[model samples]
Target: MTLVLKPLAEQVMVITGASSGIGLVAAKLAAARGAKVVLVARNDASLTEAVEAIRAAGGDAISAVADVGDIAAVRAAAAKAVGHYGRIDTWVNDAGSAIYAKLVDTPLDEHQRLFQTNYFGVVHGALTAIPYLRDTGGAIITVGSIASDLPSPILSAYAASKHAVKGFVDALRMELTADAVPIAITLIKPAGIDTPIAQHAANHVDGEALIPAPVYDPALVAEAILDAAEHVRRDITVGGAGRLQVLLGTHFPALLDRLAGVMIPAMSDKTRPKTESTTLFEPEQRGQERSGVQPGRKTSVYTAAERHPIALRSIALAGIAGATLLAFRRSRTRK
Candidate 1:
């Protein structure tokens, strides 16, 4: 089937986890770009508020309250999108929850719960959206994390769930290709973006749960998601530091592990009091963009790399050739 996706202005987008964080930003951005949007989340109140905000901005939007973790709920939500908008051109699995605890410290049930939302939720979204997307060849964008590439000390369960998400996305993409399916599957791995996730994460540590420095604005991630919806790429890392971390973990796994073991503990704030507020079992009502975490850096190298890969590769090759030539000349001079 020769599938050509519709333009954003003519497409209908369904974004899960649309009540807050990067998901909310992506919904707003997509609606602003002229796409009719369907917002899905577990919280009815927050979903209504998000829809209202989008409508207030003169964008077309509707809300469906569904927990992505539940297959039936996800399918119902997909049905609602199709019923209301007629069809879904883009489906984003951005609904996820995390836990801040050592693997041993985290309860088995808690770990299961986290995976239910992070991994199974994505699976449900993909499975439910695939049939609708298969006919027209649309996009499925899953929000993964840098943890998918490199495991973190305090967030082992969360990291593992992200790994599962990556695995599922990879295998599904391969299967779709083999079957000649026209759907575009994309995995977006973000570094610690400023999102309410940190505040809502279930923490089993001595201090308050927090995402470390070098945080990025959630808008950066939302932009990447929207871009993937329009121009489907297989994988995209959000922050420059995240790209660096992936590269290091890929090439120097042992060294990266050793460094992370020490850095993770040192970077965390141990003095802050632990909070009881968490969205592990239920959704929180705080509806806002930007996690309130001040970004440590203002630039995203990953975005730059993605936007100008050829130019960056050329520069890198030139540098390597120049160094090689200089080394040869010095060797001859020494001889």
Candidate 2:
């Protein structure tokens, strides 16, 4: 079935993990664009602050405090959205957590908790949103990671959970399509984004956790989410660097295996103290986008090209033709 998504201005969006990071950024952006937003997260204070801030900025938004891992809570959050807005046009599953440790060193509980949030949380969000979305012909956007395809040595459990997420989303999309459900299912595979996830991670690493080099701004991901909400996309990797890593992992698994030693050390920052904070089990801090570890790029050319492929290709071909003509003129002049 062809899914026709409504314009952002005419939609009611429910975003999980909306207290901070990419989720929070997307909530604000959606509201700013005239979507009535329902922000869901475990942090009550952060949700309140985010909702108040959005309202203060002349946007319509409300907060629903619920852990995405809990299906009942997620359902209640969805009900709250429908109660407030009368219908749900888009549901974003952006709630996730991470653990920084080797698979062996990672505790079973922590690994389970990571899956609960990162994997099952997405499952919960999709299942909860599907019924309401069916009535409105809406979209379900899940924030996956490049790690969904590429495994990280130190972040084994997080990678595993994302892998599960990718599988679930793929199968669900196909099943829904076969069933003739009109809801759009999109997976957003982002690269290392500068968000508080590192600070909020359950770190078993020796030093402070970092998202590694080539991190991107959370706004880039937020843009991708909103784009999927308005337009149908199968999946989008936010950063070119991340897309490259996924390609490498796909085509040259042995090369990545060989480079593991080099990649392992890059995941931590010894200069800073090991993080004593963690959001794996509970909420720590909220209402911030960037983690301040690095200044991420303001834009991603890869993502821009992905979102507007034909337009970008037109520009690229025009530039190539112009460069060729210039080179021809230069050769003639020299002759």
Candidate 3:
């Protein structure tokens, strides 16, 4: 059977973690593009506010307060969306939590709690959304991190959860393909997004928690997620830095490991005071979009790559050739 893909205006999208960060941004953008949006998050007040904002801006939106970590709650949320919108065309698994501490330093329960939201939340969202999507061809976009591809020092638990998400997404994609299901399953891996995540993360370190430098705006990630809803792609890494890290980690694991060891320690600011704020146990206040901490880069190479893949490939090849020639010249001079 030939698969039919619906346009954004004709689809109903349910976004988890819709109260803040990338999920919230994606929800707003998707609504602006004419999609009926079902906003899901644990925070009822923030979810209501987000829905009202969408409505005020002349968009169709409904709120379902549910913790993605709870399978039954997520299932109910899905039912509510279907009950309200009649059907769901796109499901975005964007709910996530993090911890900033060494593996040994992290409490076992805290680590488990991180998994509940980050990894299992995606599981719950996918499991709940898949049946509906299987009946009517739709999309499942899971928001992962660049950490899925490479490990960060302080975010060990969060990194592990993302890795698990990648594994689940890959396996599910294969299953759907084998079964001849027309669902479009995509994983969006973002790196150092300028979102409220850093401020919201549970910090165990001595200094302030901050997303690493060269952060990309959450809007970039939201745009990518919305694009994936219309297009069929297996996975997309958002920032150029993230793509480079994946490539290097894959090809030069040892070198990347050494670099990470040096870079992670240097990035921490000792002067900044630390605070413990875990969205793991309870819902935090919202209304803020960006973290307001990091001054993100003006342009994203990943966005350019997405727009011009061929041109980006050509540029990469040329750069590799130039570096090889330069190295050869240096070797000759040494001889």
| lDDT by residue (tens digit), candidate 1, 1-335 | 55566788999999999998889999999999999999999889888989999999999999999988899999998899889889999999999887888788899998999999999999999999999988678999999998898878888899899999999999999999999999999999888888788777888877767776568888788888888888768888888887888788899989977887676675346787766788778886566666665553556865766855687688789989999999999999999
Give the 10-residue window scoring lowest on summed lDDT in candidate 2. Answer: 284-293
The alpha-carbon RMSD values of the candidates against the true structure, listed in the order shown, are 1.9, 3.3, 2.6
lDDT of 2 by residue, 1-335 (tens): 56778999999999999998999999999999999999999999999999999999999999999999899999999898888889999999999999999999999999999999999999999999898877658899999999989988998888999999999999999999888888999999999888888889999988899896688999999999999999999998999988888899999999999998998999998888998979889887665877977778888888999899797788779999999999999999999
Candidate 1 ranges with C-alpha deviation above 4 Å = 1-3, 296-298, 325-335
Candidate 3 per-residue C-alpha lDDT over 1-335 given as tens digits, one digit per residue, 9 for 90 to 100: 65666899999999999999999999999999999999999999998999999999999999999998899999999999999989999999999888888899999998998999999999999999999988779999999998898887888789999999999999999999999999999999998898888778888887778887668888888888988888787788889887887788899988977887776664456688865666777996564568787866647866667645687788889999999999999999999
Better of 1 and 3 by TM-score: 1
Better of 2 and 3 by lDDT: 2
Sorted by TM-score (best first), the order is: 1, 2, 3
The candidate that achieves the highest TM-score relative to the unseen native structure = 1
Task: List candidate 2 segments past 4 Å from native.
Answer: 312-335
What do the candidate models score in CA lDDT, each in turn?
A: 0.86, 0.91, 0.87
User: Over 4 Å off in model 3, which ranges?
Assistant: 307-335
lDDT comparison, 1 vs 2, better candidate: 2
